[model samples]
Target: MADVVNSRSRSSSPSSLGATEFKFPEGLVAHRENLPAGRVTATTLDGTLTKAPLQLIEDLSNGCGGQLWPAGIRLAKYFISRYRNGDELTGKRVIELGSGGGVTGLAIGLELDQIGGDIDEGGCEFWMTDMQAMMELMEKNVSFNGLQERIRCGLLDWADPLPEFVARRPVDIVLAADCVYFEPAFPLLEKTLCDIAGPDTEVLFCFKKRRRADMRFIKSIRKRFVMTEIKDEIYARESIYL
Candidate 1:
C-alpha cells in the first residue's frame, strides 16, 4: 500500500469561522461569496489533456456557487503531484470519502488518463462519494471536467451502512481531505474505513490539523491504524496505513 501524507496551513482570513457553528441538516452558514479562480489540469479517458477553472466552494442550495476553500485547492494539487510522480493509484480502483468539491478524486482520475492508464479501457473505476448535497456538486464537477464516464458519483454517509456499495468490489485505496470535524462522526468514519479497508488497501486523510477537537479525533484513529507523517509543516496532513 502507498503511504498517504499531508501538509497543513492556517487560513489567513476568518472564512472558516462560520463552518464550525453550522450543522448539515440545519444548513451551512452564509459567509463570503467570492470564488477564487484557478486552473486545474485534468486528463480524459482518451488520453487527451485539458484544463478547467476551479472554484473553492460549490453551494448545493443555491446552484453550486460559493467561495472555494484554500485547503481544498492545496489538497487537490497534492493529489495531482502524487499521481504524476508514479503513485500506485494511477489505475487502481479508488474511492474518495467526503469529496467536498470532488477535486481530490477528480485529480486522481485525470492523472490516471494522462499517465496512459487503463480506466478508459474498462480496467478500473473511480468512485467519488459524499453527502447527498455534496454529491450533487461532485457530479457537476466531474461533468465540468469532462470526466463523466471515468468518474461515478454517489452518496456515502460514513455514519450509515454501505453494504451494497462495498459488495460491488474491494477498493484499492480510499481518500479523504479536510473531513475530520464533528466529534461524533469520528467513530463512524473509523467503522466505515474498517468496512472497506483490507490488508492491501491504502487510505489517505488530509486535514488542517487545527482545533483540539480535530487533534483528539486524529489521535484516536491513530490507535487503530498506522499513522505516518508525510509532511508535518504548516498543513499537517498524514497518511494512514491499514
Candidate 2:
C-alpha cells in the first residue's frame, strides 16, 4: 500500500484545524464516530480482532460510491470459516483484488494468525488492491487491526497491466469479491486474472446472482477457469478455482 500518514499529534494545540487522533499501538486507526454501529471483527494474520468504529466514504470521483456489499462480507466470512483449519493458503502469499472494504483480505490474514500461523512473525505477506479511494480505506482497515507489517495496500486497476505496478511475485492465491458487476470491465477482469494467475495459483471470486449480465460474464470466464461453488447463500455465489 502507498504510505501516507495523516495524523494529529497530542502535543498539538486543540485549536489546530484537524480532527482528534486515535492511534493503535499495533498500527491500526479507528475513529469511533465514523464507523457503523454494530459488532465488526476482522480476521488478520494473527487472529480475529474487533474493528474500531470509523466512517468510510467511497470516492465518487473514482466511480465508487463507497457502498459495502453484504454478499462480499458473507463470502469473506465463508473463506475464513472454510480455511480456518485447512491447509489451503496457509503461510502463502495472497492478494485480494478490487477490495472495496477489504473484508476478505483482512479476514484471511486474521484467520491465519488465529490458527498460529507465522504471518504475524513475518512469515507471510498480504497485498490488498483497489482504486485509489478504496485503497485508502483498505490501508486504514489494515492499520486499524494493527497488521501493518503483514498487510500491504495498493491501487490496482484491472484495466491496466499487472507487471507495470506489482512486482513479479509468485502469488499463491488471488481473491475477488463483488468486482464483476460491470459488463465492460469483465474482459479486463479476465485479462488481469490471466496475467497474474499461474497454473498452481488458486483464485476465489464472490458475486451476487442478481444480475443476468453477471451470470453471462461468469459463464464466459468458466470456459477458462475451473469454477466450483463453495457457498450458495441467498443472493451470492462463492466459487473456488480449479
Best by lDDT: 2
- Candidates in order, TM-scores: namely 0.67, 0.67
Model 2's alpha-carbon lDDT is: 0.56
In model 1, which range of ten residues has the least summed lDDT?
Answer: 20-29
Regions of model 1 farther than 4 Å from truth = 1-57, 60-67, 85-87, 114-122, 232-242
lDDT of each: 0.55, 0.56
lDDT of 2 by residue, 139-182 (tens): 76666555567677877888777844354667777878778778
